[model samples]
Structure formats: structure tokens, C-alpha cells
Target: MPDQIADPSDLRGDCAQCFGLCCVALPFARSTDFALDKPAGKPCPNLRGDHRCGIHADLREKGFTGCTVYDCFGAGQKVSQVTFGGQDWRTGTKEHARQMLDVFPVVRQLHELLWYLNEALGLSAARPVHADLRRALERTERLTRQTPQELAALDVAAHRQEVNVLLLRTSELARAGVAGKGGKGGKGGGKDRRGADLIGARLKGADLRGASLRGAYLIGADLTGADLRGADLIGADLRGADLTDADLTGAFFLTQPQLTAARGSAGTKLPESVTRPVHWTAGS
Candidate 1:
């Protein structure tokens, strides 16, 4: 398995292969993440009559960068072709429409797992379980190709539990490699935070021990309950990020500017020189 996240640029997006499922099947709130509030089973306003984003060329201008970041990873095509036999929601009965909508989210989860599994397989450090990871990846890919009925009826939680066991092994292998060689990460030229936008990232319960997060943008990220023990957070932007219930015991080199940029609750533990954010006190 690979020691890092696979570059997401490798993913190909072809909505023609999909049934416009993401635009119809997913729910979103009117927040910074989404431009509008949409219910499940309803097509987004940006979705064109021809099953494409009407604002595709100007998503950033219209504040739909979150939509741009989302990648279905070909599961949309597999579900539309293999499961429903190329049937679109426009051609389906009410029951079929409901079924397709339900199955869409399931296939999306499977695709996300595929992403993680693919990443795990590229790590030379996970040699002990490289064979297992590859096998699991192939198996998951096959499951992703199942029909709508199979996908809709799948016990995804159980599959996720099974996959998580393998991911744990992968994490252990990679983290062990990081801990070796005196805790220096393999990336040459040290930590590169250039143009890194980590808004709303799930860093909760993350083991960021000894990590160099220099100049990284961590705005609105959830670091609640994170283990930041011994991390180097110099020059990182932490604006609007939540550190409530986080444990920063023994963390190192966290700058004042970084601390000032984040939000926290009273329960958040802190480094000696920095106090909690003002919002934390106001909210408390």
C-alpha cells in the first residue's frame, strides 16, 4: 500500500457515462460547501436538461468548488450500465427511481473505498499486506460493478468494517515506516504547503504526531478529538477550524499566528504561549 493519498487527478469524470446520479441523488445544504440547498432525489439547478452542469465552465465563479472536488470514480457508469442496464431515472417507474436513488449513495461509498484501496496498494512500505491489499482492491472493484439491486441491498456497513481492517493494517505499515529513520517523512525538501486547501477536512482522531504542516490551509477543518501530540504546525492557516475536544499535549513549534486563526472550545487543550480563540470563550 502507498504511504500517501493517491493523486486525485488520476480520476476521470464523464457524466455521459453516468445517469446524472450525483446531481439528483445526493443532498446538500446551503453552506460554504454548496451553493444551494437540495433534497435527495432532486436534480441540482446546475444540472442541465442534457444531464450536465450548466455552470461547468464557471463553477468557481459561482462558488461550487465543492462540486468540482467530488469525484464519483466511474461508479456512476457501472451503476447506470451494469445495474440498471443503461436505464436513466427519466425512464424508470417510481419504485425504480427510488431504488436507483438509494443505490447511487451505496455505489458512491464503494467508489470512495476503491479510492482508499488504490492508495493503499501503491505503498512499498505495506509489503507485508501488499498482496492482501491488491486482492481486496480487486474484490471491491468487482463489487462496485454489481447491479442496482445488489448495490441497493448491500450491507455497506459490514463491507466498510471489513475494509477498515485492511486499512488499519495499511496505516500501521505506513506509520511504522514514518516512525523509522528518526521520524522524518519521505517527502524530499520537507513539507510542501503550497496552495494546499484543507477546508472542512476530517482530521478528527488523526495521529498528527511529528508532522510538518507548514503553511498549510486548514480552514474550517474538524480537528475535534485529534491527537496533535508532538506535531510541528508552523505557518499553518487554521482559520475557522474546530479544535474542540482536541488534545494537543506535548505538541511542538505551533506558532501564535496559527493558533490565532483557529476556533476552539473551552475544553481544547493548548500550548503554553497561546490562549484559546475568542470565539471559544464567547460560545462557552
Candidate 2:
């Protein structure tokens, strides 16, 4: 075993080092997520001159709950320091602002891949492909460090597809250990519910370890105390899911956005990739 710690800087979001690109570049529609409608390239109304959210302390309380859960996987800093050399849009020209906004999402996609690849490395069962995963991580990291033009013109969707192949294999390797360990995962007619509309489904305390929940719409589902260890939750809509005490110790590909959207208490066991949402508390 390696004595070095597994912490990777690019995999975690450091809002302090960011230039608040997310608050300025990303557009938001007036919906359940945001309180107002803002077009692309326009800064949010609550953004301060210093790139700090003026309403950061009360985002969820004031109807901008979506902002609270958004993570750029350190893309903001990558664009701030490397792509644009730490120049803030506030001090840049119109073209610079436009270019920064354009490159933000591209770098974000690459950083997200880095996050997944880092997680895959820690899974013991995925050892067979760990070397490949490391290579992909390095390639993706290099892509994130490229100049603004190079990043903007990147074929991001194609790269995402290639990375997805590796992630799928990792999921299979990890979940195979749950074959008959009292888990109903990938069994019991537990049909692949990828992107299914299971909103508000009464799945409380369900035995779903190692199940594939990729892109499943579990919005507002009653999954309190469910066992989700080793489940594949990549792209799954966990917004509003009741995971009060759910065991997600080994859940794969679960992102900050999905967890932010859901309501989970302190008892909800999460993987190291994401942080516990502040809104999750007793009786939440």
C-alpha cells in the first residue's frame, strides 16, 4: 500500500481560490432552483464586487438553494489561475469575459471526470484498471490546464463518453462483491431504473446495495434509512430524496449536485467525494 495520502486538489472545489465564475457565467432560470432568471454571461444579482455571494449565508432560506449545492470541481480556480492567469472578469475586457465564460463549462466537465477517476482509484476491486484510470486522470488534468482557446474548443462530450466506459467497468467490479450478501441489488426484479420517474416512491429502508441508479429520477422519494452501499448513482436525480439515515458508504459517482438536492440528515453515510449538505440536520 502507498504511504501517501489520496487527497487530490483538482477533485475538490476551493471556492476561496475561485473568481466566482459560477456566480457570473452560468445562467439560471426562475424555477425551484433559483429565485430569479439570469441569462448567460450576466452576473447574479446577489454577487458582490469581490466575487463573493452577498447572500451566501441565506441561499436556501431565500430560495436560491440550487446555488448552495453547486460544485465546479475547482474549475473556477483552474480557469482563474491557469487559463486566464488569475485575471478577474471585472477587470477584463468584453472579449475576455466572453472567453472566460465559454471556457468555464468545458474545464468543469474535465474536472468532473478527474473527480470520478480519483474515486475509481480508491476502489480495491477496480485495481485491474487502476493504471488506465490514472492515465485518464492525468490526460484529463492536462486538458484542464490548457489555454482558454484550447479548452473552449475541446470535444468534451466525446471525452466524457470515453471516461464513462471506465467508470462503468469500475462499478461492475465493485458491485460484484454484493452477489449474495443479503443485498437485493441487481436482483429481485430490481430492474435497471436508469432515469426512471421514481419521484416520491415509497422505498424507505429498501435493500438496494450495489443497485444501479444511474440517471434515475428519485426526486422526493421516501428512501429514509435505505442501504445504498456500493450503488452506482452517477447522474441520478437525488433532489429531495429522503435519505435521513441511508447508508451510502460505497455509493459510486454520487456528485455534490445530487446530494445537495436531496435532504439527508447527519446520519446519512456519504463517500469522501462529497460533503454533507448543511441543511441536513435532526428531523430534516
Candidate 3:
């Protein structure tokens, strides 16, 4: 997992190597996640030919809260410089464009994992696997820098499986202290929501799976790449929370209202059957 304590200079707005693929590679409906409906692979209306967001200066006001939380972990540069050899999708050869398209999602997934893996390494509570986590981070970082051919042809699922094994280990180590019997975070404490104002907390790559976060205030929290599967988020205020690449496959009580109230980048994955929330419209 990559660290959430990102260098201010390395954040999304400062990245230069990527051609703003997230604005195009991902699909967006006119909802809380995007300002308009954009099919996957089609360039976003706000995306400039120069690979920048045309509305980068006022994305939030324009109903692009989800874009505000996205980060590529410098993978965009690697893809541009090393993989596709500096070819932007707009002017690249058809094969080059296809390669870029194919690898964008894969690199996005790896970069998400890298973000969490780095965070796990820095956690004092996860000391037992700190060294292992560091090694895993390095490994994932190398994987993320692969050339386009290598990345496009790679088995991303298998890579994810390999990285997940380490992430699971890291989670077990970090949460070990909180998981003891009659220890700190038991069922009784889990229900206590007093003063849990975790607004804008950097919870990237956190394993909040199955936790009862009822009524928790999670506004602007960077939950990118976090493992929130099966967590109870009922009544939690998720306004401005970044769910890019975060997994909520089995999360409970996360309704459209909650999603609308909160912000999710294009990389955010929701359960099937629920269309993208409808707050990301132009005036939303």
C-alpha cells in the first residue's frame, strides 16, 4: 500500500507524466462522482488535448468532487516516458493508444495498492511486518514502472493477488493490537461513536472492513485504496470523502444518498445495479 502522507509536491495536481487518463479511461455518470456522463475510453469533455483537466481550477464547484481526490502515484509519468515512449493518446499511433488504454486501468490498480502499501510500512502499530511491508512496497513500485508492453501484457489480477497477500499480512500486523480479546477495539468500543470526528483523516489503504462507523463524520477523508469491504457506514457523513480505488463491495448501508453526500472519484467502485450517483452534474 502507498502512504497517505503524500508529499505536497507529489499530489495529483502536480503530476505531469500522466496524460489525464483518469478523466478519460474511467466512466462517469451525471452524478456525485462526475459533472457529466462519460463512457469509458472516451475523452472527458473537460479533458484537454494537452492531458490536463480543462476545469482543474474549479472542479469542486463544477461537480467534480471525485476528481479532487484522485492520485496516480506517478504511474502516469512512467507510462508516458518508459512505456509508451512519450506518446499522448491523442496523437499516438492506434496501437500506442490501445496500449495506453489497456494499461491505464492496470496501472491505476497497482498505484492504488502502492499507495496503501507505503502507508502500511509507516504505521507504528504494524511494526511486526514493517520490513516486509517496505519490501513489498518496493516490489510494487517496480511493477508500476514497467513499460507499456510489459504493463499491457501483464496479468494484473495475478499481480493484485500477490500484492494482496502482503497487504493482508500488513493489515493483520497493524490491527493486531486493536483485535485482541477484551483489548482496545472490542464490540463494545466499536459501537461508541462519540467524538469520532475523523474529517479529512488520511485513512488511505486502511482496513476498516466490518467496522461499525455509524454516525461517523468522514468528510474529506482520503480513503483511496482502503479495504472497506463489509463495513457499516450507516448515518456516516461522507461528504468529500475520497473513495477512489477503494473497495466497498460488501459495505452495508452505503446508500445513494450517502454517496451523493460524499464524493467519489471515477476510480471508486460500487456494488452492481446502483448507477453512479446523480450529484456530479454541471451545477451540482
Q: In terms of lDDT, which candidate is strongest?
A: 2
Per-candidate TM-scores read 0.62, 0.92, 0.60
Give the backbone clash total of model 1.
5
Model 3: how far residue 230 lies from native, Å: 19
lDDT of 2 by residue, 1-284 (tens): 23112346666678777788999889999999899999988999898888899999989888998898888988898888889988888899989989999999899889888878888888888898898888888788889888888887899999999999999888788887553234444532223556778888998898887777888889899999988887888889888889999889878788888898899897889987678876789768
| Alpha carbon lDDT at 72, candidate 2 | 90
Off by over 4 Å in 3: 1-13, 178-284
Residue 60, model 2, lDDT: 83
Superposition error at 214 for model 3 (Å): 14
Error of 3 at 51 (Å): 2.3
Please say which candidate is ahead in TM-score: 1 or 2. Answer: 2
Candidates in order have lDDT scores of: 0.67, 0.83, 0.64
Residues 1-284 of candidate 1 have per-residue lDDT tens digits of: 13333333323345778888888999989876588899998989888777788998787579775575565766677677767888888787989889888987887777667766665666565678877777777777778777667877889999877987786566555444233123555341122333467778998876665455545688889898776654445446776778887777644335444665566777788865355654366333
**Candidate 3 RMSD to the correct structure:** 10.8
Worst 10 residues of 2 by lDDT: 182-191
